[model samples]
Target: MDFWNRNRAKLAEKRRLRAARLQKKSNPSSAAEYQEKCKEASRTYNAKRLLAFKKREKRAEAAEVKHGRKEANRRQDQRETARDYKVEYELMKSGAEDAFRERVMHAMWNPAPGEYRIQFSDGSYKYFD
Candidate 1:
């Protein structure tokens, strides 16, 4: 059994080597053609990869610009809110003490259900229902 197995293995190896030699002699141009095709494929793959990278960079730049614009707008909105609050505070400080007290009393006396008084920067009160 061991002798038969060794003989079979040697026969298979000789058959494989013979087949390889036959194939190499039969198709000599196939190797060069394969290498040319591989080079072309690699070139196209690199071109596509570079294009994708550029597109990704462009998108990232646009996103950064968009984020910057949004941040600027947010800062502008915060500044406007602060300015409005400052103006309201100044108006409240500049008004006479008696007038302020009278307005508060008037609002308290006219308290309506489900309505709240909103004081404006101009020292005027309005009911928010």
Candidate 2:
């Protein structure tokens, strides 16, 4: 064999010997000691798993509360918008905000063929031929 091959084989042998020595040193000698080690490892794993579950649950609760508030606020805004459009624009006497706004948008963007829509700075609009 070449010199390089011989050196490589020696290095591999040294590594194998080192691994064997480490395994022998760490090998548990007593049954009670082994059982203690296993129990400790199990306890550590269970604690970590419990901690992770708690964190996940806490995050879910926070997201639910945040999304719940958002939904409530959105509903309130829609009701207020519907009320204001009824009062301010004198557009319709009664309708949901969604329908009212859709009607307004359709009128604004797609007026009659010859009619033009104009928006003033004060939020009022007019239709003219």
Candidate 3:
């Protein structure tokens, strides 16, 4: 078995050498042609790779936009839901809230910019500006 393996390896090596010699026998022009062919093949491969990458990028961009739109819609929906809840709460608390507003509005006064005064229910007075 060892001999057989060694002999097989030798045969493969000889074949490889023979193929190399055959390739080296080409004239300079043929060599240049071979190089040009290799370059063209490489160019074609690179172009295909670039096209695939661009396609992936386009898909990614589209997904991002779709996700962004969904997020925007979600945020808007949340805001609307919150507003609806706020309206319901306000309607339930309308009398108390309105009374509080009136009391606060009557108690507090803004005489000027950055100036305010608060009036207590008592007759006592304090000045602030």
Candidate 4:
């Protein structure tokens, strides 16, 4: 109980000092100074925030440009691949036709006795009457 009483007095003294400090800060001159400090702090904070926003926007634009280039390259690669495949198919088809023509010419030029060449629908040749 004695300790509590002693502490209570100390608490009251501390409260008085805090109140006096608050009262001093609430004076017109001190209030103006405090407002100016607050304004300066707010300005700095807003400037920092604006700079960060601009940096983020720049990064986003760069990323979009990079993505666009990548997409264009991908499309170009696909087109090239398709063109290559078409050319390969055409070359293979021409080679097959040439081979078939050569075989027919050879058969016509060298006919055996009572043997004739017959062509099937599946691009095959057989010996028949």
Top TM-score model? 4
List TM-scores for all candidates, in order.
0.56, 0.52, 0.55, 0.57
lDDT of each: 0.71, 0.69, 0.68, 0.70
Worst 10 residues of 4 by lDDT: 101-110
Off by over 4 Å in 2: 1-29, 91-129
- The pairs that clash in candidate 2 are none
The residue ranges of model 1 lying beyond 4 angstroms of the native Cα positions read: 1-26, 96-129
Order the candidate numbers by TM-score, best to worst: 4, 1, 3, 2
Query: In model 4, what lDDT does residue 16 have?
Result: 100
lDDT-best of 1 and 4: 1
Writing each residue's lDDT as its tens digit, candidate 2 over 28-119 gives 56545756888999999999999999999999999999999999999999898667554534443343546555556433433578554635
- The alpha-carbon lDDT assigned to residue 51 of candidate 1 equals 100
Query: In candidate 3, which residue pairs clash?
Result: none
Measured by lDDT, the strongest candidate is 1
lDDT tens per residue, model 1, 1-100: 6999999999999999888767756786865676688899999999999999999999999999999999999999989866855654443466554655
